[model samples]
Structure formats: C-alpha cells, structure tokens
Target: MANENCEILFDYLRSILYDSTPTQIDVHSLDEDFQKLGMGLQFLDHAINELKQCSTALAKGNLSEFNPSRDNFLCDNLKNIHANLEHLTWQAKQVAKGDYSQHVSYMGDFSNSFNQMTEQLKEREEHLKSEAELEKKHAETVNKYNQLLLELIRQSNDDVLITNIDQSTILYSSHNKVRVEQENEILYYFYKNINNPCEWNMKDKDNRYYHIVTINMEWQDKPSFAHFIHDITQEKKEWDRLHQQAHIDALTQVGNRYYFQDEMQQFLNCKTTATLCYCDLDHLKYVNDNYGHDKGDTYICDFVEILKSNIREDDIIARLGGDEFCILFINGSIDSINQKMEFINEEFSKQVVDYPQSFSYGTIYINGNEDTSLLNILQIADQRMYALKRKRKMTT
Candidate 1:
C-alpha cells in the first residue's frame, strides 16, 4: 500500500512540474509522510493558480490585483511594473493637460520616448502661442493706423472720399454731402481711367473753386478711388489779382509797356490789320522843371483821360514812358483815325496850363499782308511825330 501511495505522489509531482494537465493526489489513502507531501503539492498548486490570476489581471491592465510582499522574483517584478505603469499613465494625463514638465525615470526606452514627446509638444505649443501673439499685434497695429488715417481725413480742409468703381457705394467721405455738380462727373471719368490719376477744376454752389484729384486704390478688397478735392478759391483770387497787377501800370492804372509789347506781338503773329499811333507830350520836361513833377504827372494823367475818352473801347492805349504814349486801333479806317486825332488835338488845345499840355502825334497803318516788323513800324511813326513836332515849333 505504501508503494502505491509513493507511486501516486511521484506521478502527481511529475505532472505538476512538466505535464500540460496536472494529476491529483489522494491524501486519505496515504501514510502521514505522504500526506504531508500531498499538502505541499496542493499549496504549490494554489500559489501557481494565484500567480496565473495576477498575470491575467496585469495583461488586462488591472494593477490592484498585483501584490509584491506575498512573493519574490515574478510577483515583485509585476508589482514594480504595475507601479511604473500607473506613474506613467498619470504623467501622460499631465502632459495632455499642457504640462510638459512631467517625466518618467525608470521606464527604460519608453522613458526616453515619453520625455522626447513632451519636449516636442512643448516647443510646438510655444510656437503656436508666439504666432498668435504676433497676429494679434499686427491686427492691433493695422486698426490703429486705420483710425489715425480716418481722423486725418476728417480734419483736413481738403475734401477726401473713398468709393467703389461704380459709385453706387460711398465708403468714406470727409463731407457729408458732395458740394459740386461736377464732382460726380469727375468721379465717373476717374473710374473709366482708373489706372491714371485725374485732375480738374470744380466750382461749388457758392462759386468757390476747388482742384480735384482722384487716385485709384483698392479698398476692402474691391477696386476703388480716393478723391482729394482741395479748396483753391482764395488761391485763384490771389492769382488773378497778381496777374492783373503784373499787366496793369501801377501809376496810370492802364496797360503797361510789358502788356503793350505782349499784345503787339500777339497781333503781329496773327497778322491783324491795325493802326499804331505814337504821341509825345509836347513840353513834359519843361513842365517838370518849372512846376515840379506833380504838375507834370497831372498833365500826363489829363492827356491819358482825354485819349481814353476819344478812343473806342477796342483800342489799346499804353504809356510807353514819362513823355511817350502809343495807341493800337484794330482794323480802323484812316479817315476815322484822322478825325479822332483832330478831335484829341482840339480838346488838348483847350486845356489851360503854365506849360504846353499839347502832344505831337503820328500814325502808321498796318495791313494784314504787311511783312514789316513791329520795331520798323514804331521807328517810322516816331520819325513822323518828331518831324511834325519840329514843323509845329518852327511855325509857332
């Protein structure tokens, strides 16, 4: 009976060590020593079964089932693995929440991989934040510049406007309403030639003049124009006043020598038929020597008034110098000119002055086909006047 019990124990131990299916031992039929051996085999089976359960729990990622204090080697390793895995899981969650400071110390190659992933994530996050800040600053700068530009336009004396190509929509305007009828026409012309800058004069309802300038531009991603209408009413008036002062004689308030030359050149260039009359105050130097320059000036002024009264409005009269004067009559007949000259002489003869207030006069007729220069014509007239003056002096 002892031999049979021994054989059963050996068979069960062999099966437990190397067989796929372990054999069972019957302790009730064995002696006390064999029964003790059977109890030890059962304890080993219980320990292996517990290990299998722990391994299955670990494979399924359940760490609570593993215990290290109960065994050595395999169980202790599993315990350390479970703790490391739990720590790594917590570190992963921290990283996910934007905490790149989390690190693994004891996960071998996985520690290096995790740390590298965190570093890369941190760099990417910082890059994105920097880009976002730059974009925000750019947007703010653009807005500030736009505001300043708007205020400048609003405060300027020059009218500023921004509009689309069709003029259907007005984007911005310095003035609430357009002040001129011609502004719309100018804007239309600007749109037709958008590539070129346009400029023109415009008059407002108050008769004020403005210089309009239109420049092509893009606004809000659409084709548009910026119209600058500068007020030039005062400038125009000032210019006209200056122009008049330049042409007018300061002393006589009539055409000066410069104006006469300019007009004569124009007439000559046009080949206009005209008559030029030259007159010299008979004794201007004598009057100035005896009665002072004031009296001579008065005499000159009186003679000019008489000439202006007797001559037609179309004729140009000019004071060439202190004692010389000239008149240009456009297309005048010689008979009519002679009659006017006689009338002027009679009027001057009636004047009562200490010195002679009379003037010596000569005339030259200019045909449209004449090839004579202005200087030659003036020389002939001057010679005739001097000859007539000499004859008058001798006769007197």
Candidate 2:
C-alpha cells in the first residue's frame, strides 16, 4: 500500500517536471526500490523498529551487521523531503498573511505551481485596492456637494420654501409665515406649490380688504422645492395716496389747475372733441368784508362741493386759482354744455336766497373752423365771462 502511494506522488511530480510518464513500470515491482515517503516520519518509524530489533539481538549477545549504503540513502531522502516541505510551508504563510504579491521562489524547482497561484492573486489584489481608493474619493466628493448645498440654503435672504407638489404643506419660510393671515389656507397651499419668479396677487385671510402682491419662484434644482409670497397692501395704499396728491388741490381737497391743464393738453394732443366752461366769482372780497375771512373760506369750500356734485365724473373741474374755476367737458357739444350750464345756473340762483354766492361763466367749443390753441381759447373764454358779468350788473 505504501509503495502504491509513493508511486502516485512520484507520478504527480514527474507529470509536472517532464510532462510525460513511464507506463512500462509495475508500481509494486521489487527492483523499483521499495521506499516510503522521503520525509523523516517514515524513516523515524523504521529507525525505531530497527533499534528495537538490534537491542534484542544484542541482549542475546548476537547482532546483524548494519549496511552503510542503506543508511546513507535513507538519511539523504529524509533531508531532501524535510527541506522541501519547510520551504512550501513558508510560502503558504506569505500568501495567507495577505502578501498576495509574494512569489514562492523554487527551492529546488518544485515551487513553480505556488508561483503561478501567487502571480494571479497579486493581479486581483491590485485591482481590488484601486477600486477601494476610487470609492473613497467618490464618497468624499458627494459629501462636499451636500455641505455646500446646505450652507447656501441657510444663507439665503430670499424667502425659500421646500415642499412636495402633492402634499398640502411641506415647509414655508419664516418671512412668509409672518405675513400669513388667520384665515389663510391657500397661502400654505400656494407656498408649497408655487413656482419661483412668478407674480401673484394674494389676500390675507384676516385682511381680505387689502390686496397683497405675492411673488413666487423656484427655490432649488429639485422639483420638490418651490417658493412663494408678497405683502403689497401697504405699497398699494401709498401708491393710491401719491396718485391722489398728484392731481388734487391740497388746501381745498378739490381738483387743481394742474389737473385741468393736463387734461386739456391730453385732449388737444389727442384731437379730442370737447368744450371748456370757465367761471369766476364776481365779488369774492365782498364776503370777506361783510362777514369775515373765515366765512369767505367757508363759502368757497361749500361751493366746491356743489361743483363736484353737479359735474359728471368724466368732466374735469378744477380751481384755476383763488376765485376762478375751469371745466373741460369731455366729448360735449356746445348744446350739451349749454344745458349743463343752465342747470348749474338755476342751482346757483337758489344760493342767493340764503347765501351771497354768484358766479359768471362762458363756454367754448373746438369747432372745425377754430384755429386757436387751447390756452388762447381759454383767454377768449375769460373775456366773454367778464363781458357777461358786466352786462348782468348793468341790467340789475
């Protein structure tokens, strides 16, 4: 059985060494040396058995002579086997210790197999190491982008909101929250879904009386994030006040000469059909004399209200100066102006029953044949007003 095993190991060695085989030899044949493995394990067993037999022989005072050639052969084979196995054991330790780059140099030409395995392992190890380094660098790059994105969001002054399109409310800015009214349900909904840089007009729930201008914009590169809101109530009020002041007489709170001038210029420039009715108080100083300057001022204020009530909203009525007033009847014919004047004259006549208020006025139309400028035409109307006042005084 030992002989068969030894022959098997020798065949493996021979196949690698020469890549051929001796098919003619019988493994159990006696001429082919009957040897076990050349490692000292078998040699030790044989040596122990021999020593015992020799001891017993010697005890009987008889012994077999030892052969010098056999002893030399056994020791040489054992030394070769022990040396080769110890070298193989050292190569295995290098491989198992993660030194896949390690090569097992042939101790006596038997290490070629181990060398091939180590070379392949070394190639795989190099690839794995490179892959690991790339992954580490990629992870670091992603972390940096995340940090920059967070920092940008925290630093923005523009109201930014984050929300899902489907969700009723995801997140809103504190700036927006402050402007939200008690009854505002849509504000929350709008904040979530609003696309940025868009204009929207909104009303707060508590303050539906005022309009709030809202601006919305996209907040991030992601679709999940959107922005909203503007509170323009105060701005609108200020705008209206400024607009009023532009065309109003500050003291009397009526339309001023500047407004009348602008409207006349617009009419003339646009070639609009219109008539002008110019009126002047006949004796404003008489009231200042009979009563007081306070009564005179009261009389002027009362007359302004009457003028405002009598004229159509489209008509431009203005105090040209202290005691003179101008009216531009938009698209009115001479007949229309006459009818309106007659009505105002009837009302003014009634004021004489209790109040000392009387006025004289004249009207002019932009007839196709008239080649006069609006300013010159106003001058002509002024002359006509005074002429009528003089005629009325003479008749009274």
Q: What are the per-residue Cα lDDT tens digits for candidate 1 across 187-207?
A: 654555553568767665567
What's the true lDDT of residue 324 in model 2? 86
Candidate 2 lDDT over residue span 13-110, tens digit each? 45434432322223344223443332333344445445444445444534233222356443454445445555566667888777765565646455
Task: Kindly provide the TM-score of model 2 when superposed on the true structure, using C-alpha atoms.
Answer: 0.45
| Model 2 stretches with alpha carbons more than 4 Å out | 1-219, 222-230, 242-246, 250-252, 262-271, 352-355, 366-377, 393-396
Model 1, global lDDT: 0.80
Candidate closest to the true structure, highest lDDT:
1
Positional deviation of 371 in candidate 1, in angstroms?
Answer: 5.6
How does residue 371 of candidate 1 score in lDDT?
A: 84
